[model samples]
Target: MANPMKIRAAVKDGVTEVKVLMSHEMETGQRKDSSGNLVPAHFITELTVVWNGKTVLDAQFGPAVSKNPYLAFKFKGGAKGDKVVVTWKDNKGDSRTDEAAIA
Candidate 1:
């Protein structure tokens, strides 16, 4: 299992801002390892963010993304105490889901 994601959500002036820090190796197959062998590509392929059961952000990531990615986004119509959920699926079939309440 991977490390738990760090999520922070806050609402201000009817806009909710969410920040997330995802933990992943994000290895690209083109890279060479210590043994001079090509490393298998492993990176988050899809990501989604939902607030109050409504989709707020849906994105796709590729090998170009850096390891331990950090994302920040804003959406309208979220209130305090509402839930913000984030989910990501990697190319290797591994996935992670986490949530936070709006402050």
Candidate 2:
């Protein structure tokens, strides 16, 4: 599992726009290290966003995603003071969950 992550989110109107910067070393198997050996691919595979316990979005990722991925999206039906939760899981079983108060 990943160390505790930091989440930043906000709400505008009836929408919640969230941006998450997860700390990770998303290693792609196609990359080579200083020793010229192929590094095993280890990247986030799943991501989901929820508002007030209702799922708003879900996605699956691959090695192509950038390191320490930053995701931004908007969800409808969000209200002020609602709780927005973001969670992710990596291929190595590392996971994280974070929440921020809307508005």
User: For this target, which candidate reaches the highest TM-score against the unseen true structure?
Assistant: 1
Deviation in angstroms for 56 in model 1? 0.3
Kindly provide the TM-score of model 1 when superposed on the true structure, using C-alpha atoms: 0.97
Residue 51, model 2: Cα distance from true site in angstroms = 1.0
Residues 4-82, candidate 2, lDDT per residue (tens digit)? 5566667777667887787788888999989999999899999998887789989999988888888888877777777
Worst 10 residues of 2 by lDDT: 1-10
Q: Which residue pairs clash within candidate 2?
A: none
31-90: candidate 1 lDDT, tens digit per residue: 998999999999999999998789999999999999999999888888889999999999
Predict model 1's lDDT versus the native. Answer: 0.94
TM-score for each of the candidates = 0.97, 0.88
Task: Please state the error at residue 10 of candidate 2 in Å.
Answer: 2.2
Report, for every candidate in turn, its global Cα lDDT versus the true structure.
Answer: 0.94, 0.82
